[model samples]
Each structure stands twice: as C-alpha cells, then as structure tokens.
Target: MANEAATRLEDVRANIEKACKPSRREPDDVTLIAVSKTHPAEKISPLLEAGHRVFGENRVQEAQQKWPALREAYPGVELHLIGQLQSNKAEDAVALFDCIHALDRVSLVKALGKAMDKAGKRVPCFIQVNIGQEEQKGGCAVSDLPSLIELARSADIPIAGLMCIPPFDIEPAPFFAYLAKLASDNGLEQLSMGMSGDYETAVMLGSTHVRVGTALFGERRKQEQ
Candidate 1:
C-alpha cells in the first residue's frame, strides 16, 4: 500500500510540474490535498508513511472518528474540511480543521466567527461559489458573493480565498478560469479548485490548492456521505 501510494504521489507531482511549466508557476505553489473523506485511517496511514501531509475530509463526524489518532502518530498533518458545513457543527469544525473550503453563507460565517472566538483559533476559509449556478451545489450564488465576503470580513472569519466544483461532465477549465478571475477581483490570493480529474488544468490556471482523492488512494471503498 505504501508503494502504491508513493507511486501515485509521484505521478501526481509530475503532472503538477508539467502543468506548471506553461504558466511559469512552480509546482511548489500548489498544495496537494488528498481527499480522504470515506477512507478509514488504516488506508490513510500508508500515505502518511509515504510523507503526504495535507488531507481533505468531507464530513466532520467521519474525520473526528479517524483523524485524532493519525494526527497524534504523525504530527504536522494539515486537515481541511472540503464539504458543506452545517452551522450547528461550527465549533467542532473550527476545532478540527486547519483550513475550510466551504464557507458559503452569512449564517455560517456568524457561527464560525463565534466558534473561532471561543476556540481562540482562527481557521482560514475559502468561500465556495456556485460558479455553475447548479441548483444542487452547496455554494453562495455568484450574485451574493460580494455581500457574503463583506459579511465574513466583518465577522472576522479570516477569508483565505475562493473554492468551487464545476458541474461534472463539462470542461472544467472555463470554470476554473472564472474562479481565478473572481478571486482576483475580490483580491483573494488562494484558489482551492480542481480535483482528481482536472487538477492539471487547474494548476495551469493558478490554483493554489488541489484536492485529489481517487487518483491518490484509488477508488473509494464506500459511497461518500
């Protein structure tokens, strides 16, 4: 398992390098977040042994179950919450995640603000935008982004950047590009875009962070919740 994980990590790094060439961006500029949402800790351990440090989890509960021991065993592992976060889980999310990529609403901003204040830990957050305007996505509508950013800033939520998942089965470059533009317009520096499938394109288009799961860990063993 370690060997396979190492091989896949090398492949992904090489692809990132290739993607960086055209943009004159160093591969180091892009942080690879292995999305280990549904996978158990045993499966994740091998990658940690292989020296992968950053990981993404889609649920607060599942991550709570698996990460504490792993983090104890291997210090300095960065965890990101890449799923839609409920306002009720704000304190737990603030306590557990080092970064959050799904800050989408004003209510959530207020919740996270209070949570951060109580915990005395300010987690960097990326505002998720409904770039595709897809009804099923969990992101702030494009029209509401400015107001949302202002609210988050006022609440002292430490806005890091913008995040998005383009509608599946379509070319993702345009969506990635649009997201970059939005971040630029808003004076945000970090972009948490791309996934296992289109991370290379995302890198070429100024993605500072890419969340990869299947490509690094192979197929998920169970359905993502």
Candidate 2:
C-alpha cells in the first residue's frame, strides 16, 4: 500500500512538473490537495508516510470524525474543505479546515465571519463561482461574484482566491481561464481549480491549487453492502 501510494504521488508530481514547463511556472507554485473524502484513515496513512501534507475533504462531519487522530499522528497536515459548505456548519468548518475552497453565499460569508471571530482563527477562503452556470452546482452565480467578494471582505473572511468545478465532459480550459480572469478582476491571487483529469491544463492557465482524488488514491473501494 505504501509503495503504491508513493508511486502515485510521484506520478502526480511528475505530471505537475511537465505541466509547469510549458507555462514557465515552477511546480512548487501549485499545491496538490489529495482529496481524501470517503477514504478511510488507514488508506490515507500511507500517503502521509510518503510525505503528503495537504489533503482535502468534502464534508465537515466526515472530516471531523476521521482527521483528529490522523492529525495527531502526523503533525502539520493541512486540511482543506473543498465541498459545498452549509452555513450552519460554518463554525466547525472554520475550526477544522486550514483553508476552504467553497465560499459561495452571503449567509455563509456572515456565518464564517462570526465563526472566525469566535475561534480567533482566520481560514483562507476561495469564492466558488458557477463557471458553467450549471443549475445543480454549488457555486455562486458568475453575476453575483463581485457582490459576494465584497460581502466576504466586509465580514473579514480572508479571501484567498476563486474556485470552480467546470461542467464535466466539456473542455475545461475555458472555464479555468474564466476563473483566472475573475480572480484577477477581483484583485485576488489564489486559484483553486483543477482536479485529477484537468489539473495539467489548469496549471498552464494559472491554478495555484489542484485537488486530486482518483489519480492519487486510485478507484475508491466500493462500500460494503
């Protein structure tokens, strides 16, 4: 298991390097977030042993249940919440995640602001934009982005940058480029775009963070009936 994890990590890093070459950016400029949602701690431990420090999870509850012990064993592990955030879970999300890539609404902005003040810890957040205008997606509408950014700033949430999940089965470059432009227009610096399949293209276009799951962990094991 450990060997497999190491091999996958190497592959991902190599791809990141290859992607960086054409873009004239260093591989170090991009942070690879191994998405560990649904995977158990045992499966994640090997990657930690392989020196992976950044990870992302989809749910606040699942992360709360699994991360405490793992964090104790592997200090300095950075956790990112890369899923849609419920406004009610703002406090827990602020408390658990070092960064959040799904800040999408005004209510959440207010909730996270209050949570941060109470916790005395400011978690960097990415404003998620519905880049594809998909009806089922969790990001804020493209037209609402400017207002959302302003609200987040007024509420004192550290706006790290922008994040998006382009509609699947389409060329993602344009969406990634759009997000990059949006961030620039808002005077933001970080971009949490890309995933296992599109990360290389994302890197070339200006992604500061890539959330990879299947590429790093392989197919997630089927749940027991």
Candidate 3:
C-alpha cells in the first residue's frame, strides 16, 4: 500500500507539473488538499507517509473520529473541512480542522466567529459562492457575495478566500474565473475552487487551491456507514 501510494502521488505530481507548466505556473502554486472524505484512517496512512500533508473531509463527524488518532500518529497532517458545515457544528469543526472551505453564508460566518472565540483561535475560512447558481448546491449565490464578504470581513474570522464547485454540465473555468473576480473585487487573496476533473482549467484561471479526490485516491469504495 505504501509503494502504491508513492507511485500514485508521483503520478499526480507529474500531472500537476504538466498542467502547471503549460499555464506558465509552478505546480506548487496550487495547493492540493486530497479529499479523503470516505476513505478510512488506516487506508490513508500510506498517503501521510508519502509526504502528502494536507487532506480534506466532507463532514465533521467522520473527521472527529479519524483525526484524533491520525494526528497522534502523524503529528503534522493538516485537515481541511471542505463540505457544507452546519452552524451548530461550527465549534467542533473549528476546533478540529486547520481550515474550513465551505463557509457559505453570513450566519455560518457569525457562528464560526463565535465558535472561534471560544476555541481561543481565529479559524481560517473560505466564503463559498454558488457561482453556477445551482439550486442543489451549497453556497451563497454570486449576487449575494458582496454582502456576505462584508459580513465576514466585519467579523474578522480570517477570511482566507472564496470557494466553489461548478455545476457538472458546464466548463469550470468561467465559474472559477468568477470566483477569482469575487476574491479580487472584495480584496481577498485566495481562490479555493476546482477538483479532479477541472483542476487544470482552474489552475490556468489562478486557483490557489484545488480539492482533488478520485484523481488522488482512485474511486472510493462506498462505506456502509
């Protein structure tokens, strides 16, 4: 498993380098937070051993169970929450993850701020924007971003950037570009959009972070949890 993971990581690194070079960017310019949401903790140790320090999880519950042991074992792995986070779970989320990537609304922002205060740490977060405006998605609509950004900024909960996942049928660049503009217009510095299928396009459009899952771990086995 360790050898397999190393080989896989090399493949990803090569792909990222290729993707970056064509766009006149370095692979390191974009941070790849491997989305390990469904994979078990033991199954991911090889990835950690291979020097893949950053990981992303879609839920707090799974992370709460997995990270405590993983952290004790690895000591330097960084966990990122990359899913729609309920306000009620904000405290636990902030206390556990190094970054939260799905901060979608002002209420969540306010909740995270209050939660951060109690945690004695200013938790970094991204304002998720529904750039595609899909009804089934989790984010503030693009039109509402300004006000949301304002509210988040006023609270000063470490507004690190903007995040989004484009609708499946469309090209991700325009949506990603929209996020870059939102970050620029609002004077924010990071763009945390794109994933396995569209990450190259995202890198070309100046995405600072990409959440990659299948491309890194292959297809996940559905766990009967």
Per-candidate TM-scores read: 0.98, 0.98, 0.95
User: Lowest-lDDT window of 10 residues in candidate 3?
Assistant: 216-225
Tens-digit lDDT string for candidate 1 (1-225):
889999999999999999999989999999999999889888899899999999999999999999999999999999999999999999999999999999999889999999999999899999999999999999999889999999999888899999999999999999999999999998999999999999999999999999999999898655643
Predicted candidate 2 versus true structure: per-residue lDDT over 159-198, tens digit per residue: 9999999999999999999999999998998999999999
lDDT of 1: 0.95
Residue-level lDDT for 49 in candidate 2: 100
Worst 10 residues of 2 by lDDT: 216-225
* C-alpha lDDT values of all predictions: 0.95, 0.95, 0.86
- The TM-score between candidate 1 and the true structure equals 0.98
Residue 71's C-alpha lDDT in candidate 2? 99
RMSD of every candidate to native, in Å, equals 1.0, 1.2, 1.4
